[model samples]
Target: MKSLGEVLIQRGPFSEIVIGNSAIVRAMLESGVKVVTSYPGSPTPEIAEAINSIPKDKNPLYFEFSTNEKVALELAFGAAVNGYTSCVFFKSVGMNVVADSFVQLSMMEIPGGMVIVTGDDPGANSSQNEQDNRHYARLSYTPIFEPKDAQEVYEMFKKAVEYSRKLRSPVVLRLTTHTAHFKQKVSFGVYEPSPTGEPLFDPNANGPYIPIAQNVPVMKRRALEKLLRWQEISENYAFLQGNGSDVGIITAGLPYLSLLDVLGESAKKVDILRLGMVYPLPRKAISEFLRKHKVVKILEELDNFIEEKVKAIAYEERIDVEIVGKTDIEDWIGEYTPEKVYSVMSKFSPELVRKVEKPVKFVRVVNRPPQLCPGCGHRPVFYVLSKLLREKDISVADIGCHTLGFLEPYKVGQILLSMGHSTGTASGLSMFNKDRKVVAFLGDSTFFHAGLPGIINAVFNKHNFTLVVMENGTTAMTGHQDHPGKAIKIRQILEAIGVKHIWEVDTYQQDKLEEILKTALETPEFNVVIAKHPCMLKFTRERRRKGIIKVPQMKVTNRCTLAGVCITKFACPSFQRADDGSIFVHEDLCIGDGSCMVVCPSGALEFEKIETGGGAK
Candidate 1:
């Protein structure tokens, strides 16, 4: 049968079939890795899918979509602990989520081979922060390997698993976005899938199956002692060997690739000490390599992890070789591209001099903050709240799509705090300030993530705040991930919260929404108002997929009062300010949700879904 590598390149929508991660997959399959598991995330998602796509019949390596990173880690750990080689993967920030299980395996120690793959997003591309996972390796006192490219990533996985089993300790394979996403040619090796049957077990007092209390300290000590052996393994290993030169560039991860891309393959004046093992650092090997060279440049990304350790070691050993990396180069959180590497290199040496050009004129596009998409269901609710605010009741809102309430025309929300804070915040002020008129606006997604705690606290205490949940049947933010409010009714949660006065509002019905608000403001009890509608941007998208959403026309009418309020707060992309400063829906962008109808106090905005030749979703 043809190899799997040949299958993907032939038919995958892959913009480029030649990438780093793809190469790594081919290598893992060749090496006979028996298990893989992870959650899907950018950059790292391919790793999990790569393993899963491996022909199950050809390779018995079981693959799964673990619910969360912890589940993936534990499942892989269980297999590896029993002596079956396994791989667990997750994004870098996920490390914090799964840190609880991280230190324990090292404390308990692994009998089989285990590799924890972490893909660090340095530039916050699709992450919460730029965290260095290598520190986790050092904190756990385990070895870590960093590969710079696809070829290295493939080779390192085999070495990492081998090292983990050989030392009876788990190893971390710290992958970065650059290394995980790039494309490069990788040499192919052939091997049919070979399954390592059930893992072997040794019945001993201090074996992996031992109780936590009796064996943890002993395991920790053994893990520390095993660190000493890593230096020998790293130096003697052919993959990480340092060549002869006065300056030895001790580097790891993609920054090593950047430096190589900068230097190119031609010139070989300086020996590059490409370090795959980053944690417990293989100190003996690095120290020996540095001592032999006149100077060492630690080319790495983000914090000077390796350089800092190397500098300290050099100081302790009284080695005269200077460790220059972060100290010599500017420190910033970004991937090390060839341009940056070349710029740094040219700063000190003239061999790789490149010309600089003057800055070119560039147009500055106005960055309007994201508001409700054209025809969004969330807007009509805001329009009703705006009418309420303009007429009688003043609303306090929470953090969400509704948070745009504070942005313009509506400014409905006076305050926004943790999840469903508007309800409690408004309630606190309403009770103390004795303001009987107030409503709190929050999104369906926010209501799920942290709304319960706030609502539960408020309802029990009999807080007099009207909580208005914009229940759009989906989490609009974070790309429409599932939410409890989506599966279960939002009213169910409110009923459980013990809210006394409850009513549902169809945001599409302007007159009814206004009438409900009029009654809600007068009664002023611990009330719950849920506005339900599918997001216009999202709903019409489904119709467009079925080739249904027709071109909508803007009906010219004199009935429009031209309420500037719609333009201000209910800032839908579909709604634009004309030369007359009148807000009109951008017909091309409108999805016919009929939300603009609620916003026009003067009945200006109207829906006219007229069929045109074609319209983009």
Candidate 2:
């Protein structure tokens, strides 16, 4: 069987089942995108994975995982400005990091097109927040396209690239969680390989590409002019399906799919306008649709952006229609499902509800909170922190697998804002608290992403705090993607940044880690303790690739006093407590790294080695 990368590059007149992310990759190849860049993030990481799977020799486009979303956007923008079609993508909150540069993108002239793909997480699944990036499209004066499924993900992405080039502006291809992961039989178009070789740059042609105050007004006018042009062309993209007379529903992206699923054959009694280009919406088309129907219902997730825009259009066009949007707060909270849509539509038109299929009854399942994986390296660091830190000490947390430290038993994370903000926040706490010790934890990937500046700030300002750098070797939270940390040493970066006290300790060496962490917390000045360990999952995979079939297993021995420390405080998923108050290692879950043995007060947890083709002994 061919790999996804191999299959994506296949010259087709053929069709295959592909997820939305892979379809976007195919669209990038088909659209002749020369440069591709992204920071690994949820709902969109598969895009990079698919592109990376292709053999480097066969891959046409140049791809890079930049330090952060802003840098990724800048790299792709630079390539696009220098006459190479480029693309950059990241998850919803990643838009926040890219916002500083993103707002300026539309104001600049790009001779070669640039498509900005944002995987907007509507339900907050695998995300910190369900931010609606469609707002950025309006704020930045950039055209935005939202696709319903995998096929449209391919088709609309190709169109977005073309429109970006034509408009000489960056276009936004926004996908929610569902649309990003949705799979369908996507037919392929002829692959248009991107041009190879260095991109040509003529600085003298467009002159200075700076958005200085002198040139600001003109650039703003030009951006608005491009938006106006897009508005005219966008009418063709606004699709009107079904033909109901009394009620009409306006939606975009994943919500449109839910609307269809609930309405089913009964959809013929209602007209649904699905807007492909959500921003700079085709005003003329929306106005005409509003004029035809007596009542129009808008279905969208997270925000009422579409409803507000449509309301404005209706007011301007003098269309007398009852515009219904977000009847309850619940409508704006989560992803729209068939059941959710059915509930909303049933209230609107009782007659049509009976004709359509009733939504399946929801079954309640046990809720399981997320926890660090078995043999996770971060566990030892968090466990040590939990033991050493006093209740009054300020413990700041940054994003990553380490964020789980805030949860039960080991309540280490007291304050958290965003990626890399922990150091900065801890610095503030140290400055104000004065009496209490401040400690912040962040992963290696985040250190490279947004943690460096915070570290520099702490060092420069001479803040009093202990910063724990969990050097897990890879971007573990996002599927173990390779990062700059793999090539560069965290300690070297710390030394170069003028960090005075830096201690490197193995995360699995709990005693040494605890000692180092204890001293670091007592230090009067800014200090860093580098807890080094490979993510167990990544380690296991590497070992398996090296033909090491068996991993050491850990077992709870007779020495266990049933202290519950291993089960409650350490909280390694491998350690479980039965109803009888006896603790044992869940053999199926344990990788046998023996990190848990250090935390057992009674020396109960012991490493039980398994021989080749033999059970653990």
Candidate 3:
């Protein structure tokens, strides 16, 4: 059978040819990382998905989209203790959510080499905080390796296992968005399984599994002692070296690439040292390099991580090499654009000017910052549910791509902090009044994520509220990534949850959708609505041009006077407000997907026309 890598390559919107990062692929195949887990965010997702799909042989395979970052980390740590060389991953802020579990994992040292891959998003385009996570490795005192690009990412994975097994520490391989997402030539090779040693049971040395009063202090000491070796490892860092230093710049990961790109050919003259191992300051290697340099410049993204470490090492060593960094230079924490890096360099030495070109604005296809899809299934699902709101609706939402539901037309999602809080929040809201309809909506991904436990709580505790699990097969909002419900029937999940009154609906079918929903409202039974369909735009929009989505047509009958009640309360962007304060919809914008037809209580708003070039025929 073809490897899973072949599958993604055949089906993808990947920028580069998907063949580049096969080294990591080969490593997984070799190591047999049987337990794979992730919080379905970007950059790090590919590794989780690819590792999970690896042909499970004798391996007791389990792959999951953990509800939130914290839960995902907990699962991976649990698997590690149970004797699996498990690999768990999340984006940088993902670390923030899972900090509690992470600190626990730090307390319970790894028996097998546990690799936690945290992909840093630079430039703040996709992420909330551009705070570099190398500091987490510093704070946690976990070993960290900063891979420059895909190839380096693969190399570091192999190294991570070796370092982890030897040190008995969980090694974090930090790859930036540029490094994680961008494809480059990575040589394909066979995977190396984490060496299965005898199950380590050192009761006297402090229990590795149990975080007891006796063991916690010992564990902390071991973690710190491992961190203290950063300088030692730096002394021999083969990757962290450059020639006779006319000017030495110490940079890590993708930031190093930007500095090199800015310098162009002149970079060959200026000594450049790239550290794949960042948190363990590699102080020995760095201090040696500083001795040879006439002047030292620091290049790190989003934080004074490397610069601060370098300065501290310099201060201790008393080596006076002028540090050019965030304090004296740029204040902003983000990826150094070519201009920014070049400007920093030009200031240091007037001769390094090749005058980097400011990029011209090319007409790149802007990702329509997610509004409801022209013919999205979620539209009708929420349409009928909105009527359940007697006074006003209060909801707690989870993260995933479905956060888009709160945007324009389907302003249904109320509060979204992180993943899987919707059900729990609804439980809290239920306390105020059973009359106040609190609807909690979660996508298939989020349902799998943090919602299941909360759902179980609601089911077990008999919480009085309606819970709607919008099981759109794909994790639509975050680029249609896979979810467990992607292939599996959502009804199966609801059944597994032991919910009796589960209502399944074809959201495309209008009358039946609202009818079932209407019955569900008064039923007072804890209901589960499995609105099943692929995100039409995710698959459909990518193929042929599906025309603008519109609601069903309702002719102006006897009760029709332009009250515009439907338009005012339920503000859908598709509805056009006329000059006379009357309401009309632009038919061309309508994809003939009649979701707006719901909540029209009077049956006034229906699909009027879907025209070619003119009004409806």
Candidate 4:
């Protein structure tokens, strides 16, 4: 069977329909994107996945799963500077990491095109916060193209790249969760190869590369000039006209789709203006639309970016248009649905609007919230940490699979923040609160990404805390992308970073783990404990791929005592309890990592090799 990657890379005869994310890959391929890189994130992972899925020989683009968002943007920026079209993509919060370099990257002129995709999570669906990155485009002085669906994303991406080259600045492709995840029929287009060839760095081409104090104002002026030029040159614009209704609606991105869904036969009664190019405000186009309508309602998810601007345009242009947005009538938080849009529009057209009944399902099933996967190595670490933690001791957590410790039997992380926030915040807690001990937790990938600075903060300030570094060998949370900390042992990095006292222990070794943790708590100054273990799920798959025989399944023997220590204390998802309150191992779920065997108090769990391709005899 031909893989999705194979279909995406084809030079000709593309599929008739594709998902929103696949369309982005198709767009990249069509545009002859020389380099594609990203830090894996939800609603945007499929773009990189499609590229990585294609065989190296079949795929023309140089694709990389960068260590972090900042590195991904910088890598793509390097490619762009050397005259190769490049793309860097990440989720909403990921932009926070990239923003430092991105702000500076905006000031430079690029010979080759660059497109930065920001997959914003408006509803906080799979994210910690719902951030509006349209402000990033404004802050960076970059033009942004907001695509509504798969087809628009495909078409706008091509335009965005060209505009980036033309404007000599990176263009932001703003995608909400709905737009990126939404599946729709995208008509295929012929691949148009990028004009530039393989990039070769030129030592002599150093004029625009230097961003000294003197060039700061010069770059800012030039960026402003380009923005002014873009307002006129870019033709990828949209404005939906109604049948001369006094009440007009202005929206952009996915919210425009919501407006269309609710308009339903009453569309002719109102004017709708959907702006694809959100930044620069499309003042010329918007002013014209505002003059035609008596009253305009703005519908957008999260921030009222468009609403505020449209109101300003009305005041500046001296157009008599009453703009209503984000008031008691509608909502401003999370995502905008068709029903929400309908409720707002119904105010204008009361007779045309009718509430539609929504279907509800009442099924008797256990609530399955996301948790640590069966036999995850971090499970044991969290289990032990939860056991050892005192009421006075606080656990601070960074972004990773270990964040799951905030739930279930562990219930760690009293203070939760963004990536690398644990260490930074823990440093503050240790310094001010002398009565309590702080235990900050972060993964290997996060240590490299954002935890490094916080570690430094603690060391330099002489704050006392126990930093538990979970070295799971891969970026487990975001699909196990390779990182520097994983490549070079975290111990070496810790030593170099001035971490004098470091203890390394296998997470599965419960006795040693408990002892090491106890020592960490007892120590007065800064302490570090590295929980060294490969993610069990990934390890098992790797072993199977290498043709190694699977380990014997762990089972509950006749000596079973249903004390529930394995279930409550250890809390491995593989442990299941029968209706009679007897404990047993769900053999299919167990990876035979042997953590259960070590922790089982009654010696109930035992590992026995089964007959060839058969159950235990």
lDDT to native, each model:
0.68, 0.87, 0.67, 0.82
lDDT of 1 by residue, 1-617 (tens): 54444543233223224456665565556555667876545568776555555565554567765545666788988887777778887778667757888867676556677888888987766664678888887788767778877767777887887778777778887888888877675655564656577766554643655547866677767777887787667665424444476766777777766676677642376677777677766667777787899877777777778878989999999998877776453655666676776666676555743433446789897787756677666677676676666544567766556566666665677655444566667767777646447777778766664467667877778767677788877655434434555457878767776777888977787678778766776664677777777766567777789997565555536776666555665566766778876656666876655565555567765556454569532
Better of 2 and 3 by TM-score: 2
For candidate 3, the TM-score is 0.72
Question: Which candidate number maximizes lDDT?
Answer: 2
Residues 3-115, model 3: lDDT tens digits:
65443333222322342233454455455565667776766666655655555553334677765677777787766665567777888778887776676565565666678
Error (Å) of candidate 4 at residue 94 is 1.4
Residue-level lDDT of model 2, residues 1-617, one tens digit each, is 99888898888867999899999988988888889999999999999999998888889889999999999999999999888999999999999999999999888888789999999987788888888888888899988988999999999999988888887789999988889999999998898564565766666676457778888887888888888898997898899885757789898888787877777677788888989988889998898899889999988888999999899988887889999988887777877877777777777776665334566879998677889999888888888888888888889988999899999878988977888899999888888676788899989999999999999999998888999998889998888888998789899999999999999998888888889999998899999999999898898888889998667789888999999888888888888878898998887888988888877889887778666556445
Please give the lDDT score for candidate 1.
0.68
Tell me the lDDT of candidate 4: 0.82
TM-scores of the models, in the order given: 0.72, 0.96, 0.72, 0.93
Clash counts for all predictions:
7, 2, 20, 0
How far does residue 203 in candidate 3 sit from its true spot (Å)? 5.7
Name the regions of candidate 2 deviating beyond 4 angstroms.
Answer: 192-194, 242-244, 354-367, 613-617
The model with the greater lDDT, 2 or 4, is 2
Can you list the residue pairs that collide in candidate 4? none
